[model samples]
Target chain A: MTADMTTDMIADPSGTRSPGEVLSWSRATLEPALRGAVDTLPGSLRHLVGYHFGWWDERGGPTGSAAGSGKAIRPALVFLASRAVGGDPLAAMPAAVAVELVHNFSLVHDDVMDGDHTRRHRRTVWSVFGVGPAILAGDALVTLAMDVLDGHPATSVLAAAVQDLLSGQSADLEFEDRNDVVLPECVRMAQQKTGALLGCSCAIGASFAGAEPVRVEHLRGFGEQLGLAFQVVDDLLGIWGDPAVTGKPVFSDLENRKKSLPVVAALTSGTPAGELLAERYATADEDLPGLAALIDEAGGRAWAHQQADALVEAALCDLRLADPAPGPAAELTGIADLVTHRDS
Target chain B: MTADMTTDMIADPSGTRSPGEVLSWSRATLEPALRGAVDTLPGSLRHLVGYHFGWWDERGGPTGSAAGSGKAIRPALVFLASRAVGGDPLAAMPAAVAVELVHNFSLVHDDVMDGDHTRRHRRTVWSVFGVGPAILAGDALVTLAMDVLDGHPATSVLAAAVQDLLSGQSADLEFEDRNDVVLPECVRMAQQKTGALLGCSCAIGASFAGAEPVRVEHLRGFGEQLGLAFQVVDDLLGIWGDPAVTGKPVFSDLENRKKSLPVVAALTSGTPAGELLAERYATADEDLPGLAALIDEAGGRAWAHQQADALVEAALCDLRLADPAPGPAAELTGIADLVTHRDS
Candidate 1:
């Protein structure tokens, strides 16, 4: 094994590792199996997948860097949720790998739909590999995700989440051409698009751990609420995040006029600034910074921050209801906190 | 129930039915459950899927005709394979529905990749719905296919076929940019692209029928060879079938410079006509009829016809080896004949 792969296997003697350490350890545990699954892909698709995962460059050469890999938050959720229910995190490795694959599959396709040029400080898969190959890459990942489950009872769980995810994306695309998107509809879209998979990650993890129906339900509730919080925070990042940290153009979502949570909230809010922002949005104005200021002035930013905090608190209540083991509970709480508070 | 649906449920008084009768009966047996699964999709995706299935127009109104729906050949294969193994075809309805969903999923995505605007005498899903929604429609169909399996043993069977299908498509996309693709590689691509799912259809159906592994394997062999024959005939139709019958523009494959089996066979034939055809294919010349004539002159057409005949013979041998019941066996034979002999 390479040094990079082995180093993360050496767990800290300390019991209370930070969320970052937890994520690193989870990724280390998940990599071998994930790579093995991807390696089974056809050569043409394997190259694009590896490049998307930051294991290699576009030419199939090693990049010698892991900076392009995302934080792998979903896999971490899977591992921690399994451990929280008093199961060996190792037992949930397939669930972890499957959720991560599903997450990346959505990312690859989302980039194609949004016409985004960059991700994780590198060219997006569609931008680097062309649209057709990128679509195939996404298709391969989703198929592999189902295959990895290998008829485990959790297959239904994952498949339902996938359907919800696709439905959410369909709504997102439909909203692009409309001006009357309400907050409830927009929130439902976010839940389906982002929350469904996250909820599936926790539920599947707990199910793999042989948890009872009640515990799995509670864990799913926790993950679903946290997922909404994550999406709310993501909208915040899309508008005002530092470009260097987020690895996207400043005001990227606004540039595409995405009907994101914050923007929709502001559009539906009955304020003068809200009206003004809507007008500018309809006119194809290039004043993105000006529009961002208007959304903030219209109370969209504050409403989003409030929603994230409330959702996170609700998620913690569900976590407690699950009666999780103490150590993993603490780690899950820390991860949840990090999700809402992260700058990117 | 609607008259259209109830009409085909009536059994024939005679002991025999034509291949067309078998297909229509399969479609009738499969529609309610198939529509049930699709109706579960979120509204936005459901509309697009229904339109693509020829149940509705783009505005979501009834089409009042089934002309645009392609033959449910895969489902027919599934149902016949089940009955051939002495199981009730109705008992294998889920398998039949799942395979047909997978078939249409591939078609929806293939249209996007090939930029095909027309299918079955109508506009394709992508052409009518736009690219992003069409992609989601394809995603929904494939996900629904697995969901319809619902943790059956056939889940892995379907998943494996999906991977091979994606790999075949990847190879096809790669071939579009290269001139050195050989005959073996091209045939492998066709087998992966077309044969894998058809084989899976038969195997899954036999499995659902509680057939032994040996019988299932033989049935799969039958379907795979038949699938190759089906593809070879499809390539032939792409070149020479009348547009009024094929529902494609004249010389569509040659117009796109598709490296189909016959074209690749001609390119590697080592004949003077083959050399001339290769030279012509290298340019931007629009003499599609001339290209078609050259491919025929190079013996590509004859070779493909011979191969299709050989494959059908091999397929029949496998069918007989499975020890199928006489009635379903005859129907299967008729379907295979129709596949290899149809103009469109």
Candidate 2:
């Protein structure tokens, strides 16, 4: 993750970087521009946004540590996708910042909706600032994302992805109240919720690189598949990962009765264990570990892992189809592996 | 308000149209375009937005009436501003729709933040559809507003206004917990929250018409002053207007202990009534009528009316500075009168 490693990996055509190194480089390239854009926000919103980004404590002092700042995965994808299309990564800096801002905006609002209190090992924006200010902070971030684009041709691309993201979130909320959500619709919801923005990140990066539409579409396909894989891995982590590592309570998703992909698959499996799991889920039962066992017995765990592997493979296929530069393609592959394999 | 009257009024250079006629014409011209843009929203969000606009009932059926739809005042400003700049109002249709969408987006989110249950005689979007969906619907709308601009040169103008609007809202929420709020900052908040978008609507409309920057700035000045006047009138209405016409509970602002312009003015007036009002306001006393009387006794109401008159005069002076065409200028003046004088 050192500067020398980044330089060496990027300069050598045959060298590949780890996902951590790629993210480190991306964050280094992105943070200044990101902060500059955020600084343009009005003072009140600027303070809340900085707090949410883990750049400062709640009272606007420097946090003195980068403890809760996210992994910068989306911005990394944007920069790498630009480089894959043979563009200087700096040319796509605005796109990268916009994507990151949108991601954080969704995180802030989603925390309020989901009623979660923690993320990335820190108290969430709503938990600390109150819901009204949190909502305004989210609004300011999304607005700033568009303003940073400054009438670029990619504005429509970003807007469409935002629409899809909102629709996906709408569907996800609706699913919470309904007992009859099917597997296909749940999958579609996940794609809309998570895949759209990731796909947009790649497509926008390529477009910023002046890539042909075909290449941009392929890059988008690559990101969409990877995003689905990431979600699958995330769902698995939500259920089984160590609470300390994940920065969330153990079985928090189950406690909320979130219809994660694995849970939905288990509910619709038509196995005896699936029926038992459903009966337990309908009641106020608190046996989260037992429910996890039933989902495993219903083959949900295996199905999710298989989906992740297949999605990642498909994402790699799209990466190849985009005819990316070999070095960036290798780094993207590394990132995909990390996304599907990481514990948190 | 009739087709023949509208045609006759527009055709006759010497004849002037009423504000109601101007608004009717604006609504007629704006509705289809606004609906078309909203229809592009994903179905889930579209449903909620339509409900918010009073286009349909919660079940998605026609309301069988247009009883609760807003007056479309912002869209009227956009159109009139363009026409005043000697451009065909039709050319500014997208800007009109965009301004209207931003206005509604703010309204939906503001209702959630303000915790109001009703708007325009119906349950608010959040109250009817749940807060999460309401927030999503607002997000969809602002995104769509930017998308409607579609790389237009005016996108930055709209974006800046959105930022100001959000900042003003943030300050407003902050002020709710403080007792030492001053008159000047309260006025600045109103200018940011209400004046900015109105100014933006005028500026964007004129820009769409290819008006020079000077004219655009003048038009913006006109709108900003008018907006401040409108806010003062609205604050007055919030305290004293009939519930049937204003579509809100009587003395609602006092009930919420809202630090509205007139209330703040009275609170800082250094009168005995002001001191007594402050003491009563800090209590759980439910005497809203008594509170209203204290505000009036403290000179809040008369001061507000004087301010409104001065602001409208200032707005008209700016309109004259823009060198607007005579016919549209008359209509704009009419609309300004309506805004300052209306009961609702």
Candidate 3:
């Protein structure tokens, strides 16, 4: 399609490309293959799928949808891990495409289950096309992922990750009805919901490279820790990041009453702010700056930052063990740091 | 696993068994593997999956649940087609289990989509577990199916069938809200919704037997035709069969305003009855006996029966090119007849 889609992360054989370039290159390289896999559906369904990808509008004409095709981080893991393990990154296209497909599948279904009408600053699949088609489309994407990555290890790994994802989602839904969700349980949910696929993404890339079982496990751990760190940083951003960059009101998680890790931490802090926030949470009114101050007062923000840093350190440790190359290893570590340290 | 789950359809290799006995035997043989695969899920989710399989109740006990394990027809196709092609049906266990899982996945999602509260005389997965858990469970089953049956041909075929099934369902949902549905479109939709999975089941079995491409094609054609014929018979029974046998009120398709094949055909028949039926459909309060008389008077019942029989004959012709053994061939024909000719 485009020259942009032709550049691979491996173009930097001199070991000098920045991690941002690596992520962008991997996204560009994987774009055509992802589109090709999705375009195999029959006409009408293909249009609906394209709409979800933000490549086309409801009328199937390309224009003006603001839905960014995600950050491509998981797919980056796939390609980089494959190349790091001495395999051709291009040879791992199927694995890369599979993870991206599964990631989008989860996005569509989660939007429906959460009843959220908007994502990526655009209407969701269910909001646009209705629940029936949205559900079917989600199912189609998952099946197509398997269709592309057909065979052992990949299929089992993807399926097991999906299992964990669903388990995490199940717990998340149940948590909505209870006020007793602990930090560890919430962390486990995040690991399964967000971390499992990321971990599997790296494992799949390693498997593509014919890496040994232990090596694959290490790469998976690397990605798993990265995934958990991403969630923690995300939680911190939700609560404390600038409204201009984060695109939300300050301390919005407090108003939204989401059972985020910081909320769990603050509730378990046993401080007067914890009791006041809990009271406000039950009453649907928060003391704004006071609630924000209380979360910080209870060490929630600082704790999340520490956890995120620890996770990134753990992730880098595994990455060093699994990938001895200076270039790809540096790129992976850089991307991890960028995500953790990003204001938005 | 019990002795029941251990009995293969080929256990009666002596060729004395009726087709019904063959189906029952195959299902029994596949039961252990089926249970083993489902039991792979984590504890709570496993219980939910088990309940959907009619293996347990909401309380996770084994008794007092009126649910029947499904007819296992698609799975029987996998096992029987394998044996008919001179292979051990037992070796196709993975394929058989995969098909069943996909079928149940569709069932769970479909029940939620259509808002049908009960199936096979039991509450649906969603009705018991809520929509989110049910949706997750359905997704889990599909991923699990692909996981177990990973690899070329099988994975691609299953994935494609899943796509077709979703397309058919999308069309079916749209058809419900439209008034211009024609007979051919309805038939095509039925082929996708019901026929695709069946065709894939046979194809998977053939591939498991390492059959050549042409042989696989013929077996798939046979299964596809069989699936189409099944819809025609089911439509006929829904409209005109005896209430006691069909398990519905007399001529209930009219009462429900469902656009079944016969209704679609008769609405386009151009007879006085067709005009009257069309008008009555718009009004939504038709005289039951009069609507029934009109449909039959317009030759709707006869037409469906003819279509069913012709489709079976077409299916049989393909079977003739497939298994040349008199015994297994005759058994397949018998099963086809049993499905097509039954009132319910």
Best by DockQ: 2
* Winner on DockQ (2 vs 3): 2
Which of 1 and 3 is the better model by TM-score?
1
DockQ of 2: 0.85
Candidate 1, residues B1-344, lDDT tens digits: the string is 22354534533213556788778777777878888989988888999999988989999999999887778999989988998999877788889889888899888888988999988888999999899999999888888888788788888889889888998988988888899999999999999999999899999999999999999999999999999999999999999988888888788889888999999999999999999999999899899989999999999999999999999999999999999998889999999999998974
Task: Order the candidates by TM-score, highest first.
Answer: 2, 1, 3
Poorly placed runs, candidate 2 (over 4 Å): A1-14, B4-15
Candidate with the greatest lDDT versus the true structure: 2
TM-score of predicted structure 1: 0.96
Q: What ranking emerges by DockQ with the best candidate at the front?
A: 2, 1, 3
> Which digits, one per residue and each the tens of the lDDT, describe model 3 over residues A102-170?
999988888778776666656788998888788888888888888888675577788888888888878
lDDT of each prediction vs. the true structure?
0.89, 0.91, 0.81
Q: Determine which window of 10 residues in candidate 3 chain A has minimal summed lDDT.
A: A1-10
lDDT tens digits by residue: candidate 2, A106-213: 999999999999898899999998999999999998888887898999999999999999999899899888888888998998899899999999999999999999
> DockQ for the candidate 3 complex?
0.57
